[model samples]
Target: MEPTSSAPGQLQSVTRALSVLGCFRNGEDLGVSEIARRLDLPVSTTHRLLAALVEAGFLDKVDVSSRYRLGTALAEYGQIAYRQHRIHLAEPHLEELAAITGAKASVATRHGNDAVLLGTSSWREADGHELQGLRLPLHASALGKVLLAWAQAGEGELARLPYDSGTARSISGPAELGAELARTRERGYAFNDEELVSGFRTIGVPIGDEPGQVRFALGLRGPVELMIDERVPFFVDLAKVTARKIADVLR
Candidate 1:
């Protein structure tokens, strides 16, 4: 007689396959043995799963190393998930914010050590920056700073500050970034003055009220001349209100 179990063999296979896929880290590749060791599974089982994933277009094998990494299929699914979880909920609010501010508006969510732009809104005649589907450095972009500031404090993974330079004003050290994050937390917003892009400025606010636990950020961007110190307060207020609206919809 066949053995009884809480999960059927097919379901177990599906779970194991997903676990194998999960082992591929961002910017890192893995061979079958490494994956099997991580999953605590037999080498033969891991190889079978990897082959199946490669066949299904869920993973790609490197020509030189024979290692496996995430494939285009994951990116396709990621975009779909981003649309469903973020873009659909944020579009109306971002549109209204852009209309009200006469500036570019965008929403972003943290992904690994980067901020992924999910949606953007711009005035009809405005030549705003197109950033949807773009991944930006966490220490340079206003939206990235906002998300990073609100990440769980003392989380070692979040503390890895790879301060890639976007402009001369970009944060270059962990100390400076930590101070900046502190200020962002205190002010309930983050500002980037030509840090990511020369001649442009941006301000961002978190979507939720809880500190150190934000999942989304809303931001406004415009030329530095247009987003002057005198006008920053107004834009910040608008961003906060719009963030609240988006949060309401998300909730």
Candidate 2:
């Protein structure tokens, strides 16, 4: 969903149209009515927005299903953005880390109140192929905590965290999260002990040169049984080494 209020001169139609595009997910098609229900707009208004997007190559209609999917234009733009981020340079290192850890490894950055996966390598069942571009709640993910902790997010951003989006193990509010972040900073890493998904654990390490200058983070995820306390130091050390490799490539 999109925010209702826009800047003084912003066009409502443009905002609505962008929101319609955001409704789509990886490998999924959605009909106009479903999109309308998600955005809580009238079907006619949603239809008009969808039509405009289709005309602009941001969406395509499947003739058989009468559903819309993200179009080639988005894929083109996504690829352009991906290249600009230089994430490809770190892909091999991520793959190496995954192989060594027998888990999933990824690079992520903060986007609003979420952590957006930029590149990922998974050698086990814990992480799926669809992880790239996936958005995880800032309060519920190890990558997110690393970003928030090392970047020193402003008060405004901290206040807007979607605490309810995470599981029971997630930090309850800003105060609690602030304490967790302090500990994460002191320990040189962050952890997600079933905060996002039960039976899963993840460790995140900063990818930048120092605390305040961190622009990205590296994450390692596996089942809790595989990520138990006894093996955490090994995983964290490997993750930090992988993070340094990624930071070198990013620089």
Candidate 3:
């Protein structure tokens, strides 16, 4: 078992397939042509990859359209991962928090330059807002800010962020984000005042006891009117309590 001649080819195929799935990070149903363009691969090669994924139940083709969307297999795997990470244990707490605060309550972890939602509960109607599995920009999301602040990330790491993305109200540069992180640390929470989405605000707090050892963050999000400045302190207090409860269970 010294080596296999086809190992490199198999590795390349696996990488390509993962890249294709990563292209759907925004939860969009994509056509073969669009996926190929994004990956800079030829149409024939992309089509083959799509066919394999469809056969494996990782993706499903729309009946009336050529677009492809995530399949049931991915959902099954997502649930398995959720339970493995003990995120499912926080679902009930998040739901209670959402009900009490009348906003979206979620737990997230830093994934590279983004914050990936692990669990979420919304008080409002299901208006096509799927917070779980969604990636929020670090500089533009309260959860991201809390994670970055508690982690005490270095300047080089901050400089590599996508500062130009997100809403116009987002932090424009690393220096600005550094100042914001300092404020977040001082306040013991992070605030996203329409930095990620227009007309919505979020408050975030660390879940763990130690400062730089924080591994997760809890967030409460709602519309600007509902999450008014006058109510922010109240919301932050409740969120901190809920985060502590969740952390206790995780430990």
Best by TM-score: 3
RMSD of 2: 4.4
Tens digit of per-residue lDDT, candidate 2, span 139-177: 899999999999887667777887997678988998888
Backbone clash numbers for all candidates listed: 0, 0, 0
Question: By TM-score, how accurate is candidate 1?
Answer: 0.67
Using TM-score as the measure, name the better of candidate 1 and candidate 3: 3
Q: Estimate each model's TM-score.
A: 0.67, 0.91, 0.94
Worst-scoring 10-residue span by lDDT in model 1: 124-133
Model 1 bad stretches (over 4 Å): 1-79, 122-133, 155-159
Among all candidates shown, the one with the greatest lDDT: 3
As a TM-score, model 3 comes out at 0.94
Taken over the whole model, the C-alpha lDDT of each candidate is 0.83, 0.87, 0.90
Give lDDT: candidate 2, residue 74. Answer: 88
Candidate 1 lDDT, 52-119, residue by residue in tens? 99998899999899999898888899789866775677888899988887778888888877787777
In candidate 2, which residue pairs clash? Answer: none
